[model samples]
Target: MDTVIAYLPSILRGTWITIAVALCSILLAVLLGLLGAWGKLAVSKVANIFADAYTTLIRGVPDLVLMLLLFYGGQQLLNDLGDYTGLWGYIEINHFTAGVFTIGFIYGAYMTETFRGAYLAIPSGQIEAGVACGMSPGLVFGRIIWPQLVRYALPSFGNNWLVLLKTTALVSVLGLHELVWESFTAGRSTRQLFSFFFVTLLIYLVLTAISDVGLRWLDRKYSVGVRRA
Candidate 1:
């Protein structure tokens, strides 16, 4: 509809915010995932227990519940602490920050399992051989571990990313003005709900299709020389 076209810019802007939030959230998730995997794999029993607990706790909760709890509860907690100590003024958590960290925190558990499985797939003998060849732990990780870890983990990682991308829509509930919110408002004003929402659906499909293509390319690049069964 013409009305949908007229509101295109606002929808696109919301799409961009959705993309930004997904990117930042994925980055944070990856960082936390790496730390969590390391903790799970570490020699220290306490580290292992802590990592296990984290993954368990996150898995037990719904993403929406966790997001709302963090956004509202975290904001309140921060202000309350600030009030009690008088160390700072009142604090507020913006929608973007809240969305990014909440999603990141939720997905990091899944990534932990992904990375852990990938790491487990690597033969320990290869690492022992690398050590035998006078390679340091860091060098062994960089040379022998990183590449295969990526190759093994990437498919699951890609799946997680797609899921995370769709999950960005959930942030609309927090008044983030993301794609869903923009489309909803546009449709309400124009009384052409299907038109605006259909456009939103197309944009999401395009994004997912593009991501799938790029991930496939990376898969091919990493799978080089491997004999496919």
Candidate 2:
């Protein structure tokens, strides 16, 4: 107990880092998801082909392998580019940046499917009606499609977020010193592995609980005025 309390500050810092990584990754995932969904839905065959390949490739790869590749391979790519171009020198990718981007890129594929499904769930007639009523394409989507997309996507989005939160633990492999790494270090020093890991478990539960509440509120807000059969 004394040792655990002594390590509290370190654990807290790691917790904050974990949160930061997860938040940044999710934001990136959402953005990429939107763009990927658009690409899949685009009229251009090239856009559709590229988006399909992206989602398939990302979804098929293991997360840890992807992280390692991006971290090591990306740095190599940068060095190769710089060496060939003679425009700059070595640029090492930081752990935080690599962690955020790898997770985001991996989950972006899942988010693509989530958003795509949500978009399809909306009634096509409503969109046609909105267009017929002289709404611009942007306005029609903004007014009609976006709300229902949220309502439909919220469940899966929340699920993906919870998974993403857990996935942040994988970033510790990059030496980011996030929650799991911190706890492991403390546990190793104090021989209190169970205690530190237990604390880590509770912290995760708290995060997921908070996420559930927020998702519930969003679901209710977006379902407003819609009839549930």
**Candidate No. with top TM-score:** 1
What TM-score would every model get versus the actual structure?
Answer: 0.97, 0.97
Q: Which regions of candidate 2 are displaced past 4 Å?
A: none
| Per-residue accuracy of model 1 over 1-229 as CA lDDT, tens digit each | 7888799899999999999999999999988998899999999999999999999999999999999999999999999999999999988889999999999999999999999999999999999999999999999999999999999999999999999999999999999999999999999988899998999999999999999999999999999988999
Error of 1 at 191 (Å): 1.5
Best by lDDT: 1
TM-score of 1: 0.97
Collision count for each candidate, in order: 0, 0
Candidate 2 lDDT over 1-229, as tens digits, reads 7888999999999999999999999999999999999999899999999999989999998999999999999999999999999998989889999999999999999999999999989889999999999999999988999888888999999999999999999999989989999999999989999999999999999999999999999888988998889
Q: Total clashes, candidate 2?
A: 0
Q: lDDT of each prediction vs. the true structure?
A: 0.95, 0.94
The per-prediction CA RMSD against the true structure, in angstroms, equals 1.0, 1.1
